[model samples]
Target: MSDRHIQFQTLSDLYDDVLPADEREAVRRHLQSCEACALEYRRLGDTLKLCREYAGLSLPLDGLNDRTMSKIRSARTRRLVLRSLPAMAASVLVIVGVGLFSTGTVFVRDRATVAGSRLSYSDSERVIDIIRKHNATISQVTGEYVEGTVPVSSFNDLKKSMGFRRVAYMMVDESMPDENVHWGDAIEEVGHDTGQPVRDWAPLTGTGASRQYVRFRVFR
Candidate 1:
């Protein structure tokens, strides 16, 4: 092959200057005639010269190698913790399950008995009667005391029977006497004079029957 062809073909290999002496001489001869090969040789020479200049200059160290190694270790530890978390949680669940199985007798027994037992037939009847009486009392008390649309004469009789010191209808916001009234309803009924919604509000039955409010606030 011609010197030009040989040099072009082998320029990459010869760039390292590792070629045999004969091959290097051939490449030099080729570069003298071949413009393209000559240009390649000059470019390689420039790159080598630049590399040599930079080689003498020290690369800066900002402790990056140690920091990078620390980050890698941290990442590895995190991965290990993440991988083990499910197993740790599962072990805790198993321990809890064993404890529950050992100590849960009373809880399980109460649950089972409550689920299985029915009240005796006579007890059921007594319960029904008590509930009915309680409901009736509640209805009567709520009906008698809830404010609105009573005859004036009846109102006076009611006030006397209930032993109120004074009784008078007054325009008051429904929410003033009872916060349970919706704001919209209270605003709508703003101007109407009515008795306080339940001045003597009291539970009429249940364990609450002996409640102090019944004696002091209501009956008295």
Candidate 2:
């Protein structure tokens, strides 16, 4: 057989010890005659002996494993508590805020009559009645019912005339053919024309037969 074939069979038998006695004897005979096979056998034996020696030695400890595990557990607990604190605080804040808001609403509802008593007779009238009494003219244009400029002027007059502590404006846009043109848009347009900011004129909703209306508040 070739030297390569002999080396392969010899290494296989040396590692497994599975070759028959006759074959083992033949490989041993060939190893004794072949210097290359003897050198390989010696090198494999030395490597295995070194591995066994290293395996028998005890590995050194750095004390990091136990400390790291303890730190991890501590950090996990801290993270869990930190995460829970915000939710707990948020729940408390929400509960307190809701309680305060509810209390304020109840207080307002209880004192509504007392608050209304402070206002004058004309001031207490519904905005639509106030608008009509002030001789505020109304016109229908482009299928939209537009209140005349009198509402704005009368509102000023009512504030001065009745000593109306707070005068508010009520506008109804009863556009039968179109609902898209909202009161807010009208208020904004009016505000722009009046050289006042839209937000400065507090615009609220009013009921209409077929369209929407905006109500402006005059508060003392």
lDDT tens digits, residues 1-220, model 2?
3365366546756657888888788778877888887788878778778989999998887887999999999998887566446434543453454344435643555455644443332233333244446644322211111232243334444333323233334454422223443444344222332333233434333445533333343333
Candidate 1 weakest lDDT stretch, 10 residues: 135-144
- Per-residue lDDT tens digits for candidate 1, residues 70-114, read 999999888756644653454345345434434553255564454
Clashing pairs in 1: none
RMSD of each candidate? Answer: 30.4, 26.2
Off by over 4 Å in 1: 1-10, 17-43, 103-220
